[model samples]
Target: MRDPWVRGLRYLKGNLFSCPPQEALAHCISEDCRMGAGIAVLFKKQFGGVSDLKAQNKKTGDCAVLRRHNRFVYYLITKKKASQKPTYESLKQSLVAMKTHCWENSVASISIPRIGCGLDRLSWEKVSVIIEEVFRDSNIRITVYSL
Candidate 1:
């Protein structure tokens, strides 16, 4: 039998899946970015100076900041709606912004908490499909934090 998790990836059970503890995430990739698999790496974020977990960045970092949910590494992921859908160029631009930050900090890996879904009201199933397909094959390591 083979281990289901992609190499280097670990599954956190118990609190990890429920009220995951605060951890860091890496650079953000935009809607139309070329994602890498097997070759991916996820770097964690360091504290940027927030008094509380719910605190927002007073200023965007030269690199990306880590997201947290209930004191856990987290973010709500979702897909673009038809009404406010984005163009490839715009998506690419957004991704570029994130990449710039990654480059600035020399980040090689990243962790993500479902991006753009939940309460944001993006369909969970759809989000899963989009991210999987978008990041089908690349050198970038992305760890999807389960909550």
Candidate 2:
């Protein structure tokens, strides 16, 4: 087995929608499934699975997954409501749940933005560390994109 690799682009300079067709896409959202702000709006518009994600009844520390075509879309529930803020603990739990889904389904790569650092106001430095720590033992390649 090999160590998992996580890469961040200094400038990222990529589109979330343009990631390789085979790679999975992930982003943070609230448990209420209201993706009315931030990069989440794009995710909702692109995937359009509001009812399906809500049907899962995911909580603040859970991950809601949507299988579209040949890839997966991971929705990390980091807060109880769209108006509420998310804690690092909840973020970490969501990531772990997403990782479990990835491992179970043999997903090898993910394309994501600087999750939780935009409108959510999380420190990128802290969030990045948590992401690394959670996936350290898996071979899944994580690509963190920034604008």
Instruction: Score candidate 2 by lDDT.
Output: 0.89
lDDT score, residue 40, model 1?
15
Model 1 gets an lDDT of: 0.36
- Report lDDT (Cα) of residue 11, candidate 1: 35
lDDT of 1 by residue, 13-129 (tens): 322233223333532322222122211113122333223322432111112234345222222111233223333333334334444544555545555554434223445455555
Predicted structure with the largest lDDT when compared to the true one: 2
Give candidate 1's root-mean-square deviation (CA, Å): 10.5
TM-score of 1: 0.40
Model 2 reaches what TM-score against the true structure? 0.92
